[model samples]
Target chain A: MSEKIDFSHVRFLVVDTNRLMCQLVKDILMMLGCTQVTTARDSEKAIANLRAGGYDVLITEWNLKPRSGLELLDWMRTDGGSPDRMMPVIMLTANSEVEYVMESRDKGVTEFLAKPFTADGMYRRLVSVIARPRDFVSVKGYFGPDRRRQQIPFEGPDRRQQKPE
Target chain B: MRNKPQFIPNRGELKRKAVNYKTGMEIKLDEATLKKMEQLVENSSAEFLSETVASLKGLREALGRAATEPSARKEVLDHIREEAFQIKGMGGVFGYPLLTEFSKSLHDFLKELEDLDELQQEIVSIHVDTLYVVVSHKIKGSGGPLEAQLRASLKAAVDKAKPGTKPAQ
Candidate 1:
């Protein structure tokens, strides 16, 4: 595969209730050559940062005090004040389960990375959200990155292909 | 929901800003770069050890208070669950999988029980104590046979304590 990434301009917001997690992620980001990294312990603080704008990506843990990361993702997708509904979010948490993955996906999370995450894994996610941004979907209830990852060929009579409203 | 899933093209602001075809910066992390990142995490191992020790101390004290004070049990249990969860996420990150394993079990157990019974409190206490031992000795990896058995035994004790209900994950 080809490699094309530059973290010099990408601003990051990491949300986790644990000070250790926040520090670890920030350290990893710095190691990856990112200088503009902000830390938020709860969803509320995360929102304040998000509203200020300029954050290119969000990395949050699932278990947060007062408000969960899922709730933060929900607000980003659905809240009117959210500057970027299509903002890429990476859910990095210890809640490693199929159910959690599916739940985060439904909540419009761009990526789901379980904890005990490697720096390599974290870097890969950053590359994806930055270098290869995913197309978004906006429907009645949900508004964020499109959840469907694969595009299987449909050998059927009528297949609709158009930019949705 | 819309009639069809709309595919809103990403304006590629991030891509434009972060990717420079001129510089051709390879997003892939090389071995040396990866090593540097690993060292960054490993460098914090000492911090993890000391902080975890203090955290477990808090967990133990909270457990003791929950045992003696009936009124504090509700709030204390919530705090323990949150603390255990933080521990669960950190241990494996700092080369202490056993710490994660035990605390994850503790966290899940706390999730299952709204209020701790006498047996429940004892089992939770054991979980807290085991966590203390793991971090205190700087036990890394998943641990040996005895440690594995201790994890299994904790699960068994939870099953026995709860009887009919399955433990939360």
Candidate 2:
């Protein structure tokens, strides 16, 4: 793992309603050498900024005013909301329940960071998006990163490699 | 050879417009900077907890009012639930992981308020009392035997109040 990330030019858009939480995120990014950071207090404003373009990544809370972050992700992936549909998104929330994790994974989220996250935890997610970008899967009812992080050896035939009839 | 017109593109102007894009990255934080940011986060969390304690006091007052006035029960319970939700979400972030756990239990109890009989309401009151103690003491992390005992008693009461709802642990 190289310790030479240059976030000086990577633009980020942070969407969170809580002022304190937003400032904490901004400070963390700034400390990481990110200079181009934009913030939106709600989903509507986030959409407007996304449409304006030039953002490299997005960090959003699960709960937001007017629209939830899940809802925003839905629009971004399905409704052609973002100019770059492959843009990486990290979903933040206090709820670490399995249901919420599954929901976010199904909704095309690039990464999920639970609330009360440490600086190291956040840094790992950022590195994941930039260093190890996941391939997008557009199968039935799913249109996001491949949910499987590990590949298991199989004795059976490889279905993924089978040619279409 | 005849001297051709000299052409010099403004180097400074080109430098200003050049975009420096680099991907496949890793963040490296110096020890001093990391320590400073951690301290800032801690300070902010302490301030947040102080403010939260004041809010909790207000919630306790609202609970008292609800217990006394039947007409205000619904509204007061709603307010308590809202506050409990906030506590559940923020407690872990502010270094009070135990408070987050307790508040989650309280939030669940509040959700089933309408189904609770008088005995069940009493169980909820016990939970409220325990939360007050936990927050006032500024308890953090996994509390010791005392906290365990508090949780066990509350669970027993809840089981007595609403049998068959919770599976035996």
**Candidate with maximal DockQ:** 1
TM-score for the B chain of model 2: 0.69
Tens-digit lDDT track for model 2 on B58-159? 876876776677777788777777667667767777677777777778777777675433554576677777777777787775769877887787777667
Q: Estimate, for each residue in A1-165, the C-alpha lDDT of model 1 and write its tens digit.
A: 565666768899999988888998998888777889999998888988999988989999998867899998898888879888889999999998789999999899998898777878877887778887887876777777877678777788532255344
In model 1, the runs with Cα more than 4 Å from the true position are: A151-165, B22-25, B164-169
Give the 10-residue window scoring lowest on summed lDDT in candidate 1 chain B: B20-29
Tell me the DockQ of each model, to 2 decimals.
0.61, 0.14
Which candidate achieves the best TM-score against the true structure?
Answer: 1
Where does candidate 2 stray beyond 4 Å?
A: A1-3, A151-165, B1-34, B64-78, B111-125, B160-169
* Candidate 2 accuracy as TM-score: 0.76
Q: What share of the true interface contacts does each candidate keep?
A: 0.70, 0.18
Ten contiguous residues with the weakest lDDT in model 2 chain A: A156-165
Q: What lDDT does candidate 1 reach at residue A25?
A: 92
Q: Candidate 1 lDDT (Cα, whole model)?
A: 0.83
